[model samples]
Target: MILVTLLSFFISLSYETIIFCSFSITITIFSLSFISKYPSTYLVDYTCCKPPNTLRSPSHSFLKHSRLNLSSNLESVDFQMKVLARSGLGEETYLPPAICELPPTPSYEASRKEAELVIFSSLDSLFNKTGLNPLDVDILVVNCSVFSPAPSLTSMILRKYNMRENVKSFNLSGMGCSAGLISVNLAHDLLKTHANSNAIIVTTEIITLFYYTGKDRSMLLPNCLFRMGGASVFLSNKKSFRKQSKYLLLHVVRTHIGSCDEAYNCIHEREDSEGKIGISLSKKLTSIAGQALTANIHAFALQILPTTELLFFLKTLIVKKVFKQKNTKPYIPDFKRAFEHFCLHAGGRGVINEMQKELGLSWEDMEPSRMTLHRFGNTSSSSLWYELSYLEAKGRMKKGDRVWQIALGSGFKCNSAVWKCNMDIKTSSDGPWFDCIDRYPIHVS
Candidate 1:
C-alpha cells in the first residue's frame, strides 16, 4: 500500500511539469510573432526649398530671357511669347541663376552648383525641423532627371553629410516628374523589409540642362514651364516616431502605360535640327495623360473605396463588360468619400484642369495645385510636396485627415500615395508658401 502511494505522487509531479512546459512554449511563440511583424511607415516631415527672391523671374523677365535664346528665329520667338502668356504661371515664379544669365552658362560645373544649392538647402531645413541626426539615416534616394554627373547626387549627399558606411543609396535619373512618388513607393517597400530604420528622398529637376536653344515648339514648352525647386522628405518605420510623425503612409499605386506605342512615344528626349538636346512633348500628351490617370485611379479606388462604392463599381463593370451595355457611362467613384484632401501633381495649368474635370472635383479642391504651379512653376518630381506645403500653410490639415497625392511624369506613368494625418499639422514659418499662403487662390485666368 505505501509503495502504491509513492508511485501515484510521482505521476502527479510529472503532470505538473508537462503543463508548465506547454505554457512556456505558448508564451515564446506570442513574443516571436510580435518580433516578426512589419512596422508601420511614417512621413515625419518634409521641406521644400524656395530659392532667394533675387532669383524671382516675373513674366517680363522670363520673356526677355527666352528672346535671347531664340534671337535668330523670329517666328519661334513669337510662338514662345504666345505660349508663355497663357502658360498659367504667375509673375512671382523663380528661375535658376545659370538659366537667367545672358549667354546662359549651362555647363557641368553650373549644373553641380545648381544641385548643391537646392539639395543642401533642403536637407539643412529638413534636419533642423525634425532634429534627426544625419548619421542615423539608413537609406537615401536622390533623383535629378536631366543632370546626372560623375560622383552622383547620392554620393554628394553622402560625402557632405557623412552618412553611415552601410547606408543603402539609390540615384534615379531620367525617371521624370513621376519619380518623386516612385521614390516614395520604393522607400516604403524598403522600410517594410528593414525594420526600425529611417529614409530620405530628395527630388528635383536641374533647370540648367533643361533649356533648349533649338526651335522645336515641342521642346520649348519645357523651357516655359519648368523652374528651379527641390524637396527633401523624411520617412521612418521607427516605433518611437509614432507620436510625433505628421502622416502615416496608407497606400501607393503606380501605373505605367509605357508598353503602348503611342504612350511611349508621347514624351522623349532627343536632339533638334541644331544638335541641341531637349525633351519634346507630343500634342497627344493631353489625351494620353488622361488615359494614364484613369488607369491609375481605377486600381487605387478598388483598394480605398468603401463597400457600397465598391459594390456599385463592380455592378457598373458587369453591366459594361459582361452585358455589353453600349449606353452605360463609366462609373467614377466619389474620391472625396475616401480622402479629406488632394495634392494632385501641379504639372501645369492644363494638367491640373484635366485632373479636376476627370475626378469631378470642385474649384476649392483644385486650389492647392493651381496655387503651387502659379507660385513655383513646374518643379518636376518635387511639385507635389509644394502643394502639400500649401495646404499645411493654410492650416487645412487636421488629425485623421486623409491626403491623396497623385504624380505623373514622362515615363507615361501615374503614381499615387495616400497619407493619413497622424496629428493636426500647421506649416512652420519656413515653408515656400508660408508668406504667400494667404495671397493664393489667385485669379489664374
Candidate 2:
C-alpha cells in the first residue's frame, strides 16, 4: 500500500509540472502577440498590469467587456485635410577653398570678402538650378546665423533676384540649426492662411565671416567646426505642385531649452579678449540635446504609434544595460521603422558618433550624414536637406518611402521633420555637391 501511494504521488507531481510549463508558454505567446498588435491598436496598456484604481473589477470578462463597451460608444466625424509642399529649389555652389583658405591667416577683411562671395555665388547657383523667376517670389525667409549681411541677406537675395516691391521678407539671425525647420513651420502657417502664396526659405551660414581671428584654442574650434552651406527651399500651398515635391510636410516638433540667463549659457555668442565676436560652443551641448530629444520624442510618440515606444524601449535597454559600456548611449528609434531614409544632423564627428550610438545604427546607417560632413562640413540648418539630397542622388528613395530629418541648433533645441517620398528620386545635374553613391560606405577617417 505504501509503495503504491508513493508512486501515485510522483505521478501527480509530474502532471502538475507539465501544466505549469504549458501555462508559462501560453503567457509568453500572449505577450508577443500583445506587442505585435500594440502598434496598430491603442490597446497596449492592457497587456501590462492595470494601474492602482483601474483594476478593482476582477471579472475574467472585465477586459473584453470594457473593450466592447468602448467600441460601442464611438462617434463618427469628418474633417478636411490640408497639405503643404516644399520643393528643393536646385543646387548651389560651395566655395570651400575660398572660405576656409583665405590669405593673411584670415584677418577681418579677408573674412568679409569670403562672406560676400559665398552669398553671391551660392544664390546665383541656386537660381540657375531652380529655373525660378527671381521677381515672382512673394515672401523671403533668409537665415545667416553669424554673418547677417550689412543691408541684410534678405535684401541681397531680393536685389540680386529682382524680387517685387511689397515682397514680404524676414531675416532670421543667430537661430542655429533649428532655424531652418522653424522657417519651414512658419511658411506652412503662412501658406495655409493665404491663397496662391509662395514662400522662399534660404538657409546659409557664411562661417568665413565668423572665422576666429585669435589663436585661442577655444576660438580655433569654429575654424575646424563651421563649413560653407546654403540652400533654397520653395514652399507653397498649391495642390498641383505637390506631386513632384520631394517631401510633404507631415509634422514639425520643436523644443527650446536654456531660456533664462543661466540656462542661456547652454549656447551663446561671446567675444574673445581681442573683442572679436565668436560663437562659444560648449561641451554641454550634447547633454542639452539629449534632454531636448526626450521631450520632443515623448510628445511625438504619443501622437505616433506604440511600436515607436516599444522600439525605443528595446533599443534603450539593450544599449544601456546589455551593452554595459559607459560611452554607449541609449538607442534612438530605428528610424527605418518610421522612415525609409534618415537625414541626421552632420554637426561633427562626435555628434555623429553619439547619434549612431544612441540609435544602435551602423556606419552605413549614417552614410549620408557622415558624407555630408565630409563634403560640406556643418551647413547649419541646410545639412539635413543636403543629406536628403544625397539619398535622392543615390536613387534610394521610392514612392511612399518616408524620411526622418533631425536638426540641433542654438537655444540647445532639437527639431525633427518627417517627410514622405511621392515620386522617383532622380539625380540633378546642377547640384553643387555630387553624390559618390557608388563609392559609399567610405572609410571615415
Candidate 3:
C-alpha cells in the first residue's frame, strides 16, 4: 500500500511540473509576439524638383540683374561677382522667375505660385513612382524656413490634393536648413504612436520673400548662394510598403546651440540701415557651425560606431579622465567605417571644405555635396536630399549600404540622419541628377 501511494504521488507531481513549464512558455511567446509587432520607419521613395531650364541663369546674367547692381558701387558689384564665381555654383543654377525678371515682382501671389510649382512637381513625381494615394498619407510635414503662409504649407497641400479630414499635418518655419531632419525625427516619433502610417516630408526654401535687396555685404551673400529647388520624401511604417522602400531609417541626431547669444544672433534676419529686410550671416558662423556639428556627430557616433571603435573611444576617455592626459585629444572615430556614403548638406563650399579637413574625408567622399552645390546651389533644407539623389544618380547606392546625411541650418543647429539601403537598388537614369550627373565631379577650382 505504501509503494502504491508513493508511486501515485510521484506521478501527480510529474504531471503538474509539465503543466507549469508549458504555461510559462505560452506566456513568454505571447509577450514576444506583442513586442515583435512594434513598427519601424522606412524611407519609401522621394523625388526632387528640377526647375525648368528657362529659370536657369548663368553667373554673368544673374550678376547683371543683381540688387547690388542697383547700388552702382563698382566695389560692391565686384565683390558679389567674385563671391559668385568662387561660390561652388555652376552657371546653370536656377532662380525664381520673378527674381530672374527685371524689376522683380515679389508679391504674395508670386511666392504662392513658386511654392505651388515646386511642391506640386515633387509630389506628382513621388506619387507616380510609389503609386501612393494622396488621401492615404497619414501625416504631412512641410519645412520651409522663411515662408509659412496664412493657410499654412500643410493646409495648401491638403487643399490641392483633397486629403482625408483626420490626416495629421505640421508646418515648420524659422527652423532653418536642419529642419529637414527635424521633420524626419518628428515623423519617426509620430509613427511610433500611430501604429502603421504613411508620412510625407517636403523640404524647401522660398527665395521671393527672402531675396535681400539690401546692400549689406553680409545680406547679399544669400543672393550669390541660394537657388530655386525643393524635395518631397515619403516615409512609411506599414509592413506592406517595406518591399518597395529604399532605406530603413536607423537614427536621427540633432544638436541645437541657440541658447548662446552669439549663436542666436549669428544669422539674424532684420532690417538694414535703409530698413530693407534680409538675413545677415556673422563671420563667427563657421566656428559655431563646427561646434554644433561636433556635438551632433559625437552623439550619433555612440549609436552607430562599431564595438571596436567604441572601445577605442572609451579607452581614450579613460586616459583623459583617470590619467589626466590633458594633451591627448579624444579619439574621433573614423566615420567612414560607420557609413558607406556621406551627404554633407551642400550648405556652402567653405562648410564642405572644413568638414573634409576636420573629418579627414577624401575628395570622393565630399564629391556628392560639392557636386550638388555646384549644380543646384544651396536649396536650404532640401540640399541634403539633392546630394543623396546625386549618389543615386551616380549608381553609387547599393543594397545594404549605409548613408549619412548631415545638415546645418539657421537655428545654429546641426542634424544628422542615418539610413541603411533596404534592397538591391538598380542604377537608373532617374532623379534630379540623371541628365547632368556624368558632367559632375567637376574640378571646383
Best by lDDT: 1
* Per-prediction CA RMSD (Å): 13.0, 21.9, 11.4
How far residue 200's Cα lies from its native spot in candidate 3, in Å, is 0.9
- Residue pairs with colliding backbones in model 1 are none
For all candidates, the clash counts are 0, 3, 0
The TM-score values for the models, in the order shown, are: 0.90, 0.69, 0.89
Would you list the rank order by TM-score, best first?
Answer: 1, 3, 2
- lDDT (tens digit, per residue) of candidate 3 on 340-422: 99999887788888777667789999999999999999998899999888888887898899999999988789998999998
Cand. 3 TM to true fold: 0.89
The 0-to-1 C-alpha lDDT of every candidate, in the order given, reads 0.86, 0.59, 0.85
Q: Model 2: C-alpha RMSD to truth?
A: 21.9
Tens digits of per-residue lDDT, candidate 1, 1-445, equal: 7854744443344445645644675576557647645688999999999899988888788778777888888788888778878878888887888887876768778888889999999999999989989999999999888898889999999999999999999999988889999899899999999989999999999878768888899998888788999999999999999999999998999999999888888888999888999999898887888899988977887667654455556556666765578799887778788889999988887888888888889989998888888899889999999999999998899999999999988879999999999998866787898787778788888
Clashing pairs in 3: none
lDDT (C-alpha) at residue 319 in model 1: 65
At residue 54, candidate 1 shows an lDDT of 88
Residue pairs in candidate 2 whose N, alpha carbon or C atoms collide under 3 angstroms: 331-358, 332-358, 332-359
TM-score of 2: 0.69
Report the Cα lDDT for candidate 3.
Answer: 0.85
